[model samples]
Target: MIGFMPMLSKELRELGSSLKILYIPIVFTLLTIMQPVTLKMLPTLLKDASNLPEGTIIQIPDPSVIDVMGSLLPKFGSLGSIIIILIIMGEIAGERASGVMAMVFAKPISYVGYFAAKLIAGSLLVIVSLFAGMIISSYYTEIMFDKVDWLDAMLGTLLYVPYILMTVAITLCCSAFMKSQVGAGGVAFVLYLVLTMVPQYLGSFFRKVSPSHLVDTASNVIMGVADTHIVAPLVGTLVLCSVFIAAGMLLLRRQEV
Candidate 1:
């Protein structure tokens, strides 16, 4: 069995040339920059919100920068996660559709190795980009908001990896088992949206575990709370992701290629 680290490195290397990889830097920068920029502009955004007719006045609750960062963090996480999944599914199916899998198979790589590479590659790209964004955002926050609550921001930011990885894992399973790039991409995207919607519409006390709500909900845990109510949902997400990965691998192994 290939060790996960080498597999991860190999996937990261392939990511360098992929057009999809380009989105990572962009999304990362945006997520990193979003909190600072939005914090600076919230008063203005609220002012705009207040101008609306009766009952539309959103109370500009005096949210500290840390509070804003907590919310913004997840939004950024979701954006990066979705884009990665779409690209992964398309790439996997595209290779198969174009007969490029023949070239991939001709190499010494095993089916399991190839699948491992694809999943790890997708996860690494999202995690690195997410880290970059978080680091940059922290830099700006510290420089400008000297009193900003560092502990809270850090807590809010740390859960990013686990949540994003689970999301990507589910998507990779979809991509791997899919027969056509379009078929894979389309099904994955729809499933992604549906997963996202469940947490949004259905009630969940533990925000972290809710598939649809994880990214945005992740920020709640960053508020210095020792235990979040969403652990159930987060655990469910992890379980689902593992199931998807195993299923995807089974499907990939069964393919004629």
Candidate 2:
């Protein structure tokens, strides 16, 4: 196995210069634009009542920067989820299919170094994208709501980072496992769907350990709307990441050269 430092450095250079890495910044940029537009439009959205009493008076909420984050963050995060999973899937499965995996294997680099670089790099890409979206969303939210505070928005976004990391680990495992981009993408999506809807269909008690639960809980925690009630998710995410990476490495070692 190649030394850790050189392997990591080499992997970083490969990832940094790749076209696939463009997915992160592009996805993030789109979300950034979407946030403000969605927040700015929410008030008009809520005001449109499908059915209301003739004399009823409904108060329309003026969109605020926080509202943008509140409404858009979760949704944007979901979108980012797709991009992250696809990117990871491509990094792992696509490379194997396209022969990049074989080339990497020929080098002196450890499998651990190769996969770890992608995992970390992918996470950083997600972070940058999320951060950009937050900034754009906040700027627009403030314009609409007139209650935007810079500090609150910044702090809230800071609280969002761990959740992103957790997501990276979650998807990365799937990517490493499937060795096919489509398969990894499908796995992540299915997990996301179950997590996203279970709380509404079932009771809230299941939120503790659910991956979907973690995403929602973390968002709420950041916004100060709810207490930090989903500690299980945080712990589960770490476990999930470790498990995925371990499985990926084990598989890598066993793959026929």
What would the per-residue lDDT of candidate 2 be over residues 1-257, giving only the tens digit for each residue? 34456656765676668754565666676775675665556545656745655666656555544455565557766777777776666677777778877787787877777667777777777777677767766676666666565665666666556666765665666666676779878987776566555645565555566556566665565455745665676665566556666876776566653
Q: Give the TM-score of candidate 1.
A: 0.77
Global lDDT of each model? 0.67, 0.65
lDDT of 2 at 37: 68
Model 1: per-residue Cα lDDT over 1-257, one tens digit each: 34445555766777876654677766777766876777777877877766566555555556565665665675565566667666577656677878887777776666777778778777767777776777677667667554556666555555556667776766677767787777776777777767666655655453445665545546766555555556565676787778777888888778766
User: How do all models score by TM-score?
Assistant: 0.77, 0.76
Per-model tally of clashing residue pairs: 6, 3
Give the candidate number with the greatest lDDT. Answer: 1
Q: Quantify how close model 1 is to the true structure by its C-alpha RMSD in Å.
A: 4.5
Once fitted onto the true fold, the runs of candidate 2 whose alpha carbons sit more than 4 angstroms away are: 1-7, 10-23, 32-35, 42-59, 194-205
State model 1's lDDT.
Answer: 0.67
